[model samples]
Target chain A: MTEAILKVEKLKKYYPIYGGVLHKTIGYVKAVDGVSFEVNQGETLALVGESGCGKSTTGRSILRLIEPTEGRIIFEGEDLVSLNDEQMRKRRRDLQIIFQDPFASLNPRHTVQRILEEPLIVHGIGDKNERKRKVVELLETVGLNKEQIKRYPHQFSGGQRQRIGIARALSVNPKLIVADEPVSALDVSIQSQVLNLMEDLQEKFGLTYIFISHDLSVVRHIASRVGVMYLGSLVELADKTELYDQPLHPYTQALLSAVPVPDPDFKRERIILSGDVPSPSNPPAGCKFHTRCRYKMDVCTKEVPDLVDVGNGHYIACHLHR
Target chain B: MDLDKAGENVEEDYVLEVDQLKTIFRTEDGDIPAVSGVSFSLKAGETLGIVGESGSGKSVTSLSIMGLIPKPQGRLSGSIRYKGKEIINLSEGEMREIRGNEISMIFQEPMTSLNPVFTIGNQMVEAVLLHMELSKKEAEQRAIEMLRQVGIPRAEEIMKEYPHQLSGGMRQRVMIAMAMSCNPSILIADEPTTALDVTIQAQILDLMRNLKKDFNTSILLITHDLGVVAEMCDRVIVMYAGKIVEESDVRTLFKNPNHPYTKGLIKSTPRLTSEKQRLYSIPGNVPSFKEMPKGCKFVPRCEYAKDICYKNEPELVYVGEDHKSSCWLNIEQAPSIEEDAS
Candidate 1:
């Protein structure tokens, strides 16, 4: 059996909404609520959802970037929630995150060399000479040349800047990298290049990735296993083939059908959901997707459905499945 | 310059015809050719898609046709005819009559394109008032009807609301409603649903399709998404470095693409139906305007580039029935490399 590198149990991140004169907490934006998943070593687990579905928040909460409100994040068999800030800082060497926008993430003023070496310096990995050498190695690994080390972030194109971002994330040699919409900002041609580089790196490093993106096509290309999220909850989780071919949940079925296929002759029977994703702050009780779900029943409005495995490690959370 | 009278009596073959159109921008660093000798035509009730990457000049081509390019730094050459009438060198006042009434454009970011401070009713009514010779009440009624036509529920309440009050999908629908409010002969949509999510994107695309069917509006779709192109467009134009490298019917463009850039773009896009072990990526970046190569614009990144490809740029030629591609391989000895190894 493959070793599980990171396991997230009932992860919940709620940002309090302030209201009235006294600034009393009226409610919480349930961005990520009761999200549970496990990442095996050297596998890409994609978390996909819409804009306010809490895919990004789940990724951030896994790295303790946003400080998840509840649930345990057990990494390498250690409970990260019990750890202090200083402990978490030291533990972060094994955990790194690559952001969506390459333009905004990197320090514009700093050179690529300085930007890369900062992680090594903060982690106390090696000396100046060794760190400098590692930066060049990181650049070469990500398909960039050593000559570009002195240049700033603005000097590179969108694809090259993304390469720089990847190199920075790889400077410390993290085991798990939470890539939050890594290639969404890039054009189609450049986006493929980055995706290939990421896959190659995963093979070379035996890395674990919690790939968070809204684009299902990209997710299908990179992920070994897929988890579908709806309004901060995991609606369905299955192997890539099983999920795409035979999705259990109605929302997953709709989302899968919604993707515009590239072939001109392919006419998919699309499930265009009416209305927008509801406000996360006041999300519907029981099933968050009931408002948009096509097969939503009366029981879906009253009782919350637990993510239970039916067969072949395929888990689903829906009243129909239950 | 009545809106109804424009393009009303013309029994022209093509609704819009662009011949050898070139747009150059003068910057601190010399004149950069944003669009170079590009030519295409839009027939009545046809959707022509211009597909390209960020700097492939697709948006610039659309903007040039719209007469939206800034006057001081940008210069336009060649011909743009609307229903057999020259419109390239028309005065600003003359262009204004045709801008929204004859043709309208919907931008990528609806939030930025829309006036945030003004109510939706005000913006829609103003657009209608500018083009159609209708009273305020009539215009307001027309705006609400247009909004309802685009599937906006509670149209009256939405009319009173501001731009920020609606979601991304709603905002794009508003932009579409405003653009179609004038019953334009041609609608130029530059990455209309690029900002929204996939589900919302599907909804907007469906709306656009239904609207196009109902009104028979000719659409000039400019986007980087191949899937969108495959679904919406009847004819597709693949642009690279300010030139049309390939032009064909949508089926031919996807099935048997002639240009290397077109092939690469089609292969690179991951399809939901099929699974590719590794996505085939083009090797290098798109060359900047200042650092453009001597011959083929895609030479640096192209795998099939030959010696002759570096010497002289190949002209866009008919490669198949209703298909055109610009590549030296079509004219000269083909490259030694086998195609579609992946």
Candidate 2:
């Protein structure tokens, strides 16, 4: 097998819930509870879930944007979580993140050229002339003309702003990119262009991506493998085809069914869950999806299901699947 | 499935008609023609979907019909007829009476649409009392009944709770209840379920479908998602750069899309059964209002643009008896199977 670019083993990111005037830690939020996955070079691994499912937290934790309480994050065979502040800062050059909202993530005051050149200057990659040339090259790579580089963030449309974000992420020449809902804020037509651009950039640069999104259709379009998260834990992980064709987890099945098919004649028997996702701080005792799972049994409410490897590289965490 | 034939009878049954409506926003940069000549009509008990990307004038059209477009920065010019009555020239008091009583709208974000300071009961009761000449006690009773109709449990207690106290789905349902409280003849829902999760979105769509049947209210659904439109709308209007590029029954619009933009949109969307190597994306970004191409707004991104497409805008031409699309290509002469395969 080819070497994995990034391997996460038993990662856990728990936020301490504080209360009272003293602000003492009362309980844990368990944002990312014992989740683990690998992203191969030149492949996209999509992490999908609804809001409050900790998918965003997992992406942030991988980049060390937010510190994880416990876990092992191996990047290029080096333990990222164990590294010190200075070491991690130095290592950040190899890892980057593209946030969800383009307007919010980019500085309105800075021009597109400045946004793309800041990473090179911080890393001391090159001098002013070299950095300027590199910024133009990056802009061209993302399908934007060099003349538009001097424009501010608000001057461009949402799709163009996201392209600037991608150009900035590529400026560092990172091996792995954790794009958290990169195109979710964009329009439907613009979403496809961005997805295609990301794919093309991956092929040209040999980059690995952990694409986090709530849209299943977009995830299925771009992802080689997919991981479904619930509350704070990964409920399902499998190849994209296998996961879409034959989802094993109850949550995964329900999620797939809930996605509206584009064809009007294609009538899908939608499995509508009765309630919203429970809060991470007060997740159900046993299975995270037991509160919403239609196939929940007595054991589902009492015992937490273990992620078991079914045949053909498919992994599922559910009592029914077991 | 035979909605193609039903489209021919739409003109006879339409309750609301908007003819060449234009809403221009006076931005600091220039007069941004947000919605240029948008025209479509809604039948009394039918659901008409207006779909487009961000800046494609989907929400602006709905806002123009509701007379809710903020003034000074905005100016609307075009005819809007409700039950054959012109709404563009209606007095403020006349529009006010028609707004909640004859027509109501649900915004994309329910959290922002609802007032946090007021209780759900207060909002619903206020809406009812404003339209109907009902007492406070009568309005509160009707509000509780409306809450229960929307699938909220303990309607009496929910009425007492503030907007922040309920979940996102519940708050949306409350918005729906408020919109329907006045029993408006036409309801405009603008991206009502876009902010919701998949499961909750399904529930909300199902709720809307059920409510439509129960109340017999016509719906003008505005959304960027074709899936929701497929599930809810009877007739679909595909918009781009402030113009309707395609209008057809939902089934025909999906089965045999004509316009290059519509075809690209349908193919670009990731479907549940789609197993393509890569999604077929249309090239180029949507042009700004000031920079709109003189000919076709979609010519820059369209795959089938010829020399003729660059000089003149294509009018909405009849494809089938009911299906219409705006494209320079003679769709009848083009390969039929190729369009279906997309």
Candidate 3:
């Protein structure tokens, strides 16, 4: 946990909304507005929030899959935002991303062999025979057998396709993998299998993951640290145990309480927030969560709170908290 | 003297009774038996939850009860008695009267369930008028009141709008409002909160719980999430491959789950409060009915399956007082459990 593999400072990705016929920029949709975090080596940092909260945009921004509006993405002590196309492409070898949909992410036409070998070929890592050997080895690492190499993506089930996705992410021996909702689309029984395979693979390869998901239980199980997002900003950041045990921020507390515990005998008081998440395009004044926050005060609707570290690296953004 | 009279002791107590219900879909390929001999009863104001993953026939069972299964595609058998009256053989007109008036259902996707072209007020008033002998003015007034009761702000303005004008949560609230306006004796909520996010899901679940208490209406809640079953249900039935594998009171099912599948399901779901090294996942895909095994459907994935388990299908037998499990292990140990209980 000492060495930081990735550091993001005030990262922002704002999509410009255009006006009528003239097509002029009317305003910007601050999708990922002023978000920041760091990932230590071999530790999973989970970004959790509902849809339209910019969690996916942040993940894509770090990978430079989506162009950022502002801020620095420092990977291995170098700012990634400043790198040119060639340099960024070279840097991409160490940075990879796995999408949420297994069915859509993989090319339908390509067999497992071709899909796995594409990364090695593009990176100029090995000869044809060596690349073929590496593809089979990658498949073995992700728990897929050699016989599946000849099959296409559609031929496999959701879990197996996810394994293929994981196998493809590991083909170039990348250090970091931005897994965005990897298991949410899978069935409950299959979700656990995929999660177990990921944990095992992470241990074997010393991989750092930025797991973005909405399910709190899955996040609590896998993440070393968690960042709670709301309306394109980090509301709270803490260790997984500390966050779940004593969440300081109102939004974090509400989110943790809202998630239903599986055990029928285990009854916890749930904080049911009224109404839905506000539109990210036209956010409310001051604290974005003020509309639904139970502990809302006058100052909450007047001034925006900064992310302040209370103690032991637990940071929260709320008016009630220091 | 009366053989059928033996099953009448508890029949009068329940608001709805479903016995030996099986629904088979006649596909082009072959007959796919989805819901096979499912039996359960819902008492007035009791929330009976049916939980299963996809293809477990949870939805089909609800559809069968509601008489919503499309004809020429489905074949339903067995008894569905509402207020001691069988509904399976009723005509379309009588069935429609019971469907919207006596029993209303809210499906998972509110966006698709509610008509797109109709205004929220228009459709809601239509449901009220069709069910009750209310005038247009009274029904419109009742619709607005129902919308407000479900916590939709600006109810008057919302009714004038369409379904697409509302968010997923708002649309669901409207659906609940429409369903509750009739105040049906039994409400079938089929994965009502699965489409929304967690925050909104919490809100909807709270609304359902409160509505059940205030109206004293029974609910046939069907969902895949075990957490939801724990939070909202009085009793639960865990289904697997078109059969009820386990049925018991909510607490007993969670604490002393006898079926291996039930145990695996509880273990596999990650607890939000604790950290587990790895989740215990059940292996193998749910076998399609086309190539289903002859014996127990869960035979391929049961960790405790013995030679006998693979030879014959286990019937749902009483393993404990007021609890049942369909597993050979439980059947073999039934006598021992009886001795222990005594």
Query: Which residue pairs collide in model 1, if any?
Result: none
Better lDDT candidate (2, 3): 3
The candidate 1 chain B region of ten consecutive residues with least summed lDDT is B1-10
Ranking by TM-score: 1, 2, 3
Off by over 4 Å in 3: B1-12, B333-342
lDDT, candidate 2, B18-38, per-residue tens: 998999999888899988888
lDDT of 1 by residue, B1-342 (tens): 111222353763688999999999999999999999999998777788999998899999999998988987999999999888999968899999998899999999999999989999999999999999999999999999999999999999999999999999999999999999999989999999899988999999999888887988889999999999888888899999999999988888988888889889988998888777899898899999999999999999988888988989999999887799999988876753335623
lDDT tens readout by residue for model 1, A39-130: 99999999998898899999988889889999999999999989999999999999999999998999999999999999999999999899
* lDDT, model 1, position B221: 97
Worst 10 residues of 3 chain A by lDDT: A260-269
Q: Which consecutive 10 residues in model 2 chain B have the weakest lDDT in total?
A: B331-340
For candidate 2, give the docking quality class from DockQ. medium
lDDT of 2 by residue, A15-51 (tens): 8999989999999888889998887877899999999
Distance from true location, Cα of A214 in model 2, Å:
0.5
The lDDT leader among the candidates is 1
**Residue A6 lDDT (model 1):** 94
Scoring model 3 with DockQ, what do you get? 0.81
In order, the Cα lDDT scores of the candidates are 0.91, 0.88, 0.90
Tell me, what's the RMSD of every candidate? 3.5, 2.2, 3.9
